[model samples]
Target: MGWVTGVMVYFVVWWTVLFAVLPFGVVPEEAAERESGGWRGTPRSPAIVTKALWTTVVATAVWLVIWYLVNSDWLSFRTGWLAMPA
Candidate 1:
């Protein structure tokens, strides 16, 4: 149960970081257009989504490594959170 809670916490933290960093890469192109007096346009490139997905994958990997290191002695079960004790 404790290990489940810890994993949930780690996931939440990882996602939060992912969102926070996303805008840095995703927003700059628009900001550049606005700064240059160009009309803001939608991101039509599939690369944006691809980059975000890749970033997510990388972030998840990093989070997993850190989590593993911090919880090296703990056992993490695969059951859903609701199945674990509060």
Candidate 2:
């Protein structure tokens, strides 16, 4: 794949990884009465920076694997492994 395509793929992968990583380490806070009168459970510390770092790491790894597969001759996108039923 071209560099631009690779970057796009990586971007998509990064967001996907970020979504998957979001719920990790999240703990529901204790129920407390809010002035707004709505019960919303939020984690005490979301640790967004840490989660973002982890997402980048995971997305990079996954993107590398996908890049290798896309650029390699072993797996051809033109002629896929499974034959589509007519």
Candidate 3:
């Protein structure tokens, strides 16, 4: 894939992974705490940095596999069964 496409793909993969990772280890704040301030569903300890790191790691691995397939032409659409009919 071209550099631009590769970057776009990575960006998408990163955000998707982030969403998937966000729910893990989440514990909502107590109702009493919510009354003091903040959103009702806010996590007491979101561990955002940790989740972001994990997301990056997972997304990188996934992106590498995609890059390999595209670069090696194993998943190429320009030829083979993936090619469009004229």
Candidate 4:
């Protein structure tokens, strides 16, 4: 259950950041103006690819931080042990 919760939290955080930063990186003022009209232009694939790459990097960084905190005893919980008792 804890692992599931952690995974959900990580996904939420990563997606939220991705959506928030996406506008800054991908939405030029002119592009937004154009989009506001009924005629929407196709997004550049290269930009989408770059955003995915950045999102992956950010997500991995977040995961590593969470993993370190949990493993270093900085974050403790009352749950069934998944590892051999020390």
TM-score leader: 2
lDDT of 3 at 43: 89
**Clash totals for all candidate models:** 0, 0, 0, 0
Evaluation by lDDT, superior candidate among 1 and 2: 2
List TM-score per model, in order.
0.39, 0.81, 0.80, 0.53
Clash-forming residue pairs, model 2:
none
The per-residue C-alpha lDDT of model 1 at residue 46 equals: 33
Which is the winner by lDDT between candidate 2 and candidate 4?
A: 2
Q: Judging by lDDT, tell me the better candidate of 1 and 3.
A: 3
Residue 50, candidate 3: alpha-carbon lDDT: 97
- lDDT assessment of candidate 4: 0.65
Q: Model 2, residue 5: displacement in angstroms?
A: 0.4
1-86 per-residue lDDT for model 3 (tens digits): 89999999999999999999999998886563545677767888999999999999999999999999888745668865677877
Residue pairs with backbone atoms closer than 3 Å in model 3 (clashes): none
Candidate 2 — worst ten consecutive residues by lDDT sum?
A: 77-86
Local accuracy of candidate 2 as per-residue lDDT tens digits, 41-86: 9776799999999999999999999998887766764555643434
Q: Which stretches of candidate 3 lie over 4 Å from their true place?
A: 78-86
TM-score of 3: 0.80
Task: List per-prediction Cα lDDT, in the order shown.
Answer: 0.59, 0.87, 0.89, 0.65
For 37-58, candidate 1 gives per-residue lDDT tens digits of 6556544333556556766787
Among the numbered candidates, top lDDT falls to 3
Ranked by lDDT from best down, the candidates are 3, 2, 4, 1
